[model samples]
Target: MALSTHVPDLAALELLLGVAQEGSLNSAARAAGVSQQAVSARIRAMEAQTGVTLVHRSPRGSRLTAEGVMIAEWAARLLEAAAEVDAGIAALRADRRARLRVSASLTIAEQLLPGWLASFRAAGRVGDAAPEIVLTAINTATVITHVTEGTADIGFTEGPQRPAGLHGRVVGHDRLAVVVAPDHPWAGRRPRNPWPVREGTILQGARAA
Candidate 1:
């Protein structure tokens, strides 16, 4: 992993933002609920990694340099992303005991599961009152396996393998497609080859049929 790609610990990023706004290392430390000396060490470590002088220290206060402005902006965004991640995990824990436990393939997991679950909750389909949904991602076969083993109350699959003991319900229709940039000559063709996508990439998802 590249060091630049390495997101610094959240505490340090918070401290940096505080220092930028407060204009004093001591004040930043107090705002962040850390020792003034600890704040000094954090600033030193951050500067060493990025090779930019983020703050100019004086007897009265500290001021951010030009590079510091850019770093502070990006750091603020990182902190926001971190908070979102935390909230997502918290929701998972809270909803784990939901009335409906659903397993689905990646396609349905990303595009359909959220909206379906929301509608299900609004309509209270699983039970009398609003029921929470516990959603999981798996391959087509895995979804069937989980359902059979009683791991999931319901499952959605795309491919054509119907294992014994469980009934397959055709809930919806889906079709895969291939397309390229508008400038490509094949843009006029109804059916294009999937060769446009390199490994680890999918050119298109289902279009509105």
Candidate 2:
């Protein structure tokens, strides 16, 4: 069940607990690093919120009435649970930032990524606590799949067209060199115009020509 709207908030409960522990508003404010008036106001707000007179204040000091002591006990337990929740969330964030999952095409992984990661670290862009890099080398399609499926944090692949359903930008460009025998006629041709060759025949027919 949801907590009732009448329940005091965590801050107010903390202030109430402070008063209960310190035995006086002035001492509670000192322990909390707030002014005595702020602590007194917080206690009054808690009382109004819960409709219970929580603190009995006198010139001598302050004290928790019987109802106030019981409420303070419940607040202690709730605060403990809140602390555990805070710790759990912090651990998850630390784990998420501590490691990176990267998927890349095999060629890029083998030829480029090592140097890129080294440069990234040298630049200190990710701060002194760099995440551990977990690299997976696969075919380009699989790399795209990993990224689109959310199995990978990021992916690197070589192609002119962007994969569907994913955001991407070209990090770098690459080229394929057509090597030929020195004696071949095209070897010395050095044509200024781009070669007009089909994708399939670029390598095979060039070698034959």
lDDT of model 2 at position 178? 70
Global lDDT scores for all candidate models:
0.73, 0.77
lDDT of 2: 0.77
What tens-digit string does per-residue lDDT give for candidate 2 at 3-60?
A: 7978988888888888888888888899999999999888888888889988886777
Best by lDDT: 2
Residue 90 error, candidate 1, Å: 1.3
Tell me the lDDT of model 1 at 88.
96
lDDT of 1 by residue, 134-203 (tens): 7789887777777777777778777544556676655666555665799899787765444332111111
RMSD of each: 18.7, 9.4
Per candidate, the number of residue pairs that clash is: 0, 0
TM-score of each predicted structure versus truth: 0.47, 0.71
Cα shift from native, residue 108, model 1 (Å): 31
